[model samples]
Target: MIAKELHDKTPDQLRDELVNLKKEAFNLRFQQATGQLENPARLRTVKRDVARVKTVLNQKAAAAATDA
Candidate 1:
């Protein structure tokens, strides 16, 4: 879940991870809305993780574009 780990992954893998994180985030929001969320703090972590994944993905894309 760290930027260094994400940087080592291929773009496809990063995309997949991003998809999964987004799904988790959606589910967390739903749980919060229903007031059934056990760990409300999880929502914050998931949101940050999503942002981290996005940042890494953008960095990878920029690197590729410059390489071309």
Candidate 2:
């Protein structure tokens, strides 16, 4: 997912996305370890997506803090 898309989502939604991405990352790692991974690049993409989601979430939290 792109940062732009992540920015539009609420914090709860971002948290859910984060959880799913982390799960996918774990599965990808398992596949890699078992030599069953078909797309190695996917793991990298998922990792980056996770980072983007976390970044967006943090930005939202900070904005809320400042507003309050």
Candidate 3:
């Protein structure tokens, strides 16, 4: 997912997306270990997307904290 799109999402939505991505990442790892992975590149993409979501979440949190 793109950072811009992610940034537009509310924190709750981002958390949900993060959970789903982590589940996919875990499944991808399992597939890789069992030699069932079709696209190895997806692992990297998912990892980055996860990081992006995390970064956005942090940014939002920080902004909220400062505003308050």
Clashes of each: 0, 0, 0
List candidate 1 segments past 4 Å from native. Answer: none
How do the residues 1-68 of candidate 2 rate in per-residue lDDT, one tens digit apiece? 77888888889999999999999999999999999999999999999999899889989999999999
lDDT value, residue 37 of candidate 1: 98
Compute each candidate's TM-score over C-alphas.
0.96, 0.97, 0.98
**Per-residue C-alpha lDDT of model 3 across residues 1-68, encoded as one tens digit per residue:** 78999889999999999999999999999999999999999999999999999999999999999999
RMSD of 3: 0.4
Best by TM-score: 3
Which residue pairs come into collision in candidate 3?
none
Q: Distance from true position, residue 58, model 3, in Å? A: 0.2
Against the true structure, candidate 1 reaches a TM-score of 0.96
Provide the clash count, candidate 2.
0
Query: Any runs in candidate 2 off by more than 4 Å, and if so which?
Result: none
For candidate 1, the per-residue lDDT at 30 reads 94
lDDT scores in order? 0.92, 0.94, 0.97
Candidate that beats the other on lDDT, 1 or 2, i.e. the better one: 2
* Regions of model 3 farther than 4 Å from truth: none
